[model samples]
Target: MNNFKTESFDLNRAFLLDSSHPPSSIVTKLHPLNKIMAEGQIHEDIPLLVMELDNQAIAFITPQLAYQHIVQGVLNGQAWLVSFCSICNGGAVFSPLVDDEVYSFQEGGFYDAMVLLYDVQSGSYWDHLTGNCLYGSLVGKELKRLSNLLHMSLRQVLAAYPDALLALSALPEQQQTEAEEDEAWRKASEPEWSKGLVKTLGVEDNRLPRLNMGLGVWTETTRRYYPVAQLYAMNNVLIDMVDGQRLITYIDPLSGTPGAFFTDASQAEWQHNILQLNNGDSMRDMVIFDANMMLKRPQRPFQLFVRWYSFALKFPNCEIYGQPVNTQG
Candidate 1:
């Protein structure tokens, strides 16, 4: 409901790369797949957070860049905070504009196994998943949600937008090197629960493993959890009725991230590794096409990737798909 006025804010100021700099200096014009093959910095299976702005694309290595950007406050109107926790596999993008003012954020700490961000303007800690102020004057207030963040692999991103200019940081080489090292360490570390390394008090959800990854969809009257393992076992596509609306869920084979969409009409099937439709057309990943091969925006649903245990704790009554139906004689 809040109309953001981004006209006054310069996109260049928010991102490290801008038009003033020579394209060859700051921009890396390469296909994501090629980049991954060349650098070997990250695996092809890991998902990346990419944003397309004004015909350019900025890709962030989720595990590394998420923490770096939040700690460095290297974001503006053009860049929002995209945070993902490897421990829980929870990812979200937070709008910088809060309460009519733009606030810079840094890593605050943790609460209930979730990251807490501290805003520079109000000095308040906010829950990373919910964006609600926890321990500041702004307590009880919530940060506005921005556009739906896309989680996909570099290859999938380049496939969707071939002309997207991959933006890299213009920072000094030493700082960048340190960030990369930190990210590498983070990626290798396993969750405490998974290794039985740490014991903490938390709600127990027996439906699935506490550390298992799942995609969560939250609405006013409904909360649903689609376990990624179940989705994969179901051939990576699951269609079900949610709150009187037919919802289609799938895991992108390229990125391994889960996504959901609401269809005006219930019509979806899989054929030849593509999601086929009754209209004589098909969909590959997030892009949708008609029978004549025209592009269209079918529907957008609120969804995020989170751990099953985290979701269970947040929404105790949430429904889990693929659960066995209790039958009594």
Candidate 2:
């Protein structure tokens, strides 16, 4: 046998829709409950036993891979993340069972590390898990700690069945109103290849390269964060934060946007091209406001490069696609 070494198993490559992408033969089966994830509502409600292909450990990360970039830091012992706001009572719901498994703080903190966002505009970064003091660097420092807590290496449980979900309440009032507005706006902007955003969530096809950021699907309520996404869901790039960068991951031969003037060919190649565009740009003074905070409705992504990009600051420096281009196109 050829000696091939794979450190970690790719969840996406393994969950291929068809046989086009060769199977690794190592299949993990989940129960109907654990495997429950509908596109219409992108809910990241389960705790994923993430580990490497063999017995190597990753961490107890919720299947929510989009919106938030969870690297599992040292201080954050077995934590859960969501976009909910407990005080507002209008945020998304965090898996209480999963939360019980994670650690909590005493510096006047909420037991709920991951708060759901019923109101995307009112979301506060400092209150969220991303800004937690535990995370130091992006490297795998925290992920390693989270992995050590699990007993049966994730690999062993790979082919096992799924699990169950706990009782979770709905988002509060102010949050619901915002969510509806966000939903209304999402439906307004329809992608050329598919229907509007709302419809796309319900229609599941490998057509869109997707990743679930604990926030579930892109609801009108949470569409504000969609502009700065890092993952995919429903084949559409959910969290695209390319303020001064370009947007292109890999080439989806079928859905690939040509190197046109309005849309560059560069976006068709690289996945997070936005990162490349703003290679040396500093995010110190950068301020990202909710697009709908003023409109009171959901709208298309900030693709056309809104006027906010033109804001003038004292030492504001920016770039895109690796080169220094106009922040406001």
TM for every model, in the order presented, reads: 0.72, 0.24
Global lDDT scores for all candidate models:
0.59, 0.22
RMSD to native for every prediction?
9.3, 20.8
lDDT of candidate 1 over 203-228, digit per residue (tens) = 45667776677788866666788988
The clash count for each model shown is 0, 54
Q: Give candidate 2's TM-score.
A: 0.24
Off by over 4 Å in 1: 1-46, 51-58, 66-79, 163-167, 170-190, 193-201, 265-267, 324-329
Question: Which candidate leads the pack in TM-score?
Answer: 1
Q: What is the lDDT of residue 265 in candidate 2?
A: 21
Error of 1 at 266 (Å): 3.5
lDDT, candidate 2, 263-287, per-residue tens: 1223222233221112222110111
Q: Work out candidate 2's RMSD over C-alphas.
A: 20.8
